[model samples]
Target: MNAITKDVEMEQQREDRRVEMAQAKDKEDARERERRWQESHQPRDNLAPRWREVAGRDNWVGMLDPFDPLLRAELIRYGEFAQACYDAFDFDPYSRYCGGCKYSRRSFFQSLDMANAGYEVTRYLYATSNVKLPNFSRRSKRNNAWSDSANWIGYIAVSDDATTVLLGRRDIVVCWRGTVTQLEFIADIVNFNQPIYAEGIPTPDRSVKVAAGFVNLYTDKDTNCRFSKYSARDQLLAEVRRQVLRYAEERGEEVSISITGHSLGGALATLSAYDLAEEREVPVTVYSFAGPRLGNEPFKERFEEILGLKSLRVVNVHDAVPKVPGLIINENVPEFVRRAGAAMPWSYCHVGVKLALDHKRSPFLKDTAEASCFHNLEAYLHLLDG
Candidate 1:
């Protein structure tokens, strides 16, 4: 009888231990989900005041009013036309809108260059070397293997000499695409290459994950995309920030960061700008092309609070993506019509296309591509004559 009682007691104890372990695991998973949710959504505190203040300033609207009504109408119409060209490109990596179309390597490069045409032209006007180049065909390294399914992120280095000495040999253009696992590897690589900066308002707690890109996204949730891969943005940003700091210190240069991306990457860039500003007070600029909305009205307002006007610029080359910050105001409109707003009218409007076309008539395109473009020498010389 004694032996039988002991065996029963041992069995009961084992069952209780199993239940405890399961409960602990459940708690852990719940906490992780909560953390991820916070990361994916924009934080209300960051958006409220600054964004609302800037949008309400009327400075931009006032500037527009000086032009003729016909011009205003044309601007709107031209915006729509430019948008159509982007739509024709068929570059839908994030949204489900381009269901039937597929991206050929040739088409992808062509569309990319066209999209950048305006930038190239602007570079020429400023006498700066055109960073714009035609989308040349390079054999994609397993590009399509990840095409159907695989998370990817790209980083474009913009550390041109114009950026100042503080930023060193970092690539101005960097892009990466991959799943969570791939993101982790990329983050680790960035961490290895760059020194990390942990300074920022309201630092992350141990329970919270710390990253530059995702951290801002998590804060600016309302006006940004809630894609699953977005969670990695912060981690990747943390890595980049670390690198930026290392480069700045090594070169004895003041820290300045600028970020840009298209679509999902654009949304991440916006988040990154806010995070960098909040933490280091470092001057930064974010140029997002066709990024999706991250949050609600409240979040938009808060975004301005955290990221001031100088620190951020979200540009939609037409309404190619859905309604996002500083783009088409009408959210209820159909996606197709809304997207049509992306097109611009001037012959030299598209960034890459304009550059490619301009190259045919003059050596300016080739010179600008090599980064030798700068403010016009003739104009300066003419000023001396006076």
Candidate 2:
């Protein structure tokens, strides 16, 4: 062959090899993508039997739903609005009303007024709970007579529509304030450690233990031991029922209840929603932001059975609160070593449908270190606003 022909032949061979390598690399990339997809979409059988049941349930609500965008948007807006109610409690007793608080500057209720054009806050329901703290020193500089009480367990605002009631639970204010109620984390082993079903509400035939701290925070009793005479959960429910029934009688309209809260408030909201749904037989919906897990498997099962798709939990991907008191607690670990000093063999699980707002998909694990920033109500509000 001539010298030019030899050079052309060599170049042609190099081009052929390059095309072969590209095709091989493409096949490899396709296989890797398939493997990852399979891992994410694992079959139900691959999960634990109990988790299999949880996975099989059709109650989860994702952010991508097309049909219920308006409903989802409203629910999230109400969740953000609920934060204002907590802020209201931070003010003096006289300023606890919506119109008198700083949040009123950018009020969710006012926004509702503008949107509906005639919305009005008709009634405000308030409830408080007091507990005696043996270890909490009364002599501290920060301590006062009211320090032992959680003044705002929650409150319900009855709108002019008569059919809409918004329940808002107060978040933790300070370590020494009423929000300190969450610090009473001793497990109340009742009904075989399963959650004590609401009065007249049938207890499920399951063995699941829940956080007694949360339960006592919600339970109402005649005597004042660990809990007060009236719990925020019980008081809110009573007020809601009274107003709802009054509206039904006076206005001839049935009321629909919606509950929302953040942090410890979210936990109370969950407990309250369960009781309201089971006992009052009202149509109730819940939106919990950065809420901690309230119970074990049985408690979750019961909650799911009662609330089903009516509840949605908004969790930031990096939020740490939702992952704790973890689902698995080592029996051998010391109380101090465990997260939040919750030392149990088994741990709690989250209820309702989870709507995770992931800014970036890092990993499936909850990042405890990122909680301070990611678990804030502002983060949730920002996402919902978008």
Candidate 3:
């Protein structure tokens, strides 16, 4: 009987030791998990996060008053600079390449329809070379009517006493293609594995007008559609800064630049904005519509820092181009990705659209501040994330 009692006591002691061991192990695991969580949530050291904090939505109160003196002054400066550049450079609006082609026109209509359907369309156009695409054949000239592709996109206007006037008009819109040495790496990256042309490949796509003014545009195409190697990316950025500075100088204003475009133009605009910030001590603001991803995390972060609160990236839900930058880091970006990556490095803000203004009661201009795509400029200021 005593031996039995001893055995029971020993078994009870063993059970107590096991319980103590389990509790200690659990405590250790909990501590380890908390440490990891703290580390991951910690901020990194760079301009990316700093600019983001500044660019957050709370910083843009009262930005869209239109009558705001400071904002008006900035717009006037941009208008004057654009006007001078338009006057000095002879922009050929009509091109025989992409603009003049039936397929390209169809593409333009398709994009327009998307915009009309409330899908924010971001479109990009690159010249195959300097030469006109659909050369004005003698047959076309013989006919009283030029091919539909011969048309240009929008007007280049100058300011006169606070009013914008079309000083120089073209059959289409023409953007400055920087010198080959300027866009070294970017030219190579964009024009890689593409045919080299001597005459130039500026296509005459019509979407340019549809997404103008509010879009950020970028291009490195010169007389030669081809550019130098990738190492020239920095050089290209420098040239962009020079152009901004030169344009500003011509207008008798400081370096207050506003860049806009859609699709490929959006990508270029984003890149140019970043270059301006890195190469020059200027405050550059970019508004890109339906732009694609230009670089990796570093590039996006740098861009966010340069533009800060002034940068606004507008997107359409079904539009595929804007998905590029968001996808570079995450292989599969969910719709919630925007909210998930809400903690940006720079002052990057996003606006989204449900559809264009084509439906019977389209949501494009409904003025919902909560939805990113809604046209509540005032509301967007509230939602902006620095």
Cα lDDT tens digits, model 3, 96-124, are: 33222233322432332221211111212
lDDT of 3 at 383: 24
Give candidate 1's error at residue 111 in angstroms: 16
In terms of TM-score, which candidate is stronger, 1 or 2? 2
The local distance difference test score of each candidate is 0.32, 0.49, 0.33
Task: Give the candidate order by descending TM-score.
Answer: 2, 3, 1
By summed lDDT, the worst window of 10 consecutive residues in model 1 runs over 120-129
Best by lDDT: 2
Off by over 4 Å in 1: 1-149, 156-231, 307-386
Worst 10 residues of 2 by lDDT: 169-178
What is the per-residue lDDT of model 2 for residues 1-386, given as tens digits with 9 covering 90 to 100? 69899899999999999999999999999998665333322222222322212222345433335424343445444654565554544344333231122333234345433333113433333332233332211221232333334333444554443113221211111000112223232223211133355322345543445555556545644444232355545556566667666765566654456677776767767767776666665556667877777766555666777445266788887766676665354222444454433324355567777777864443433344553667567556656545
Quote the lDDT for 288 in model 1: 38
C-alpha RMSD between model 3 and the true structure: 23.7
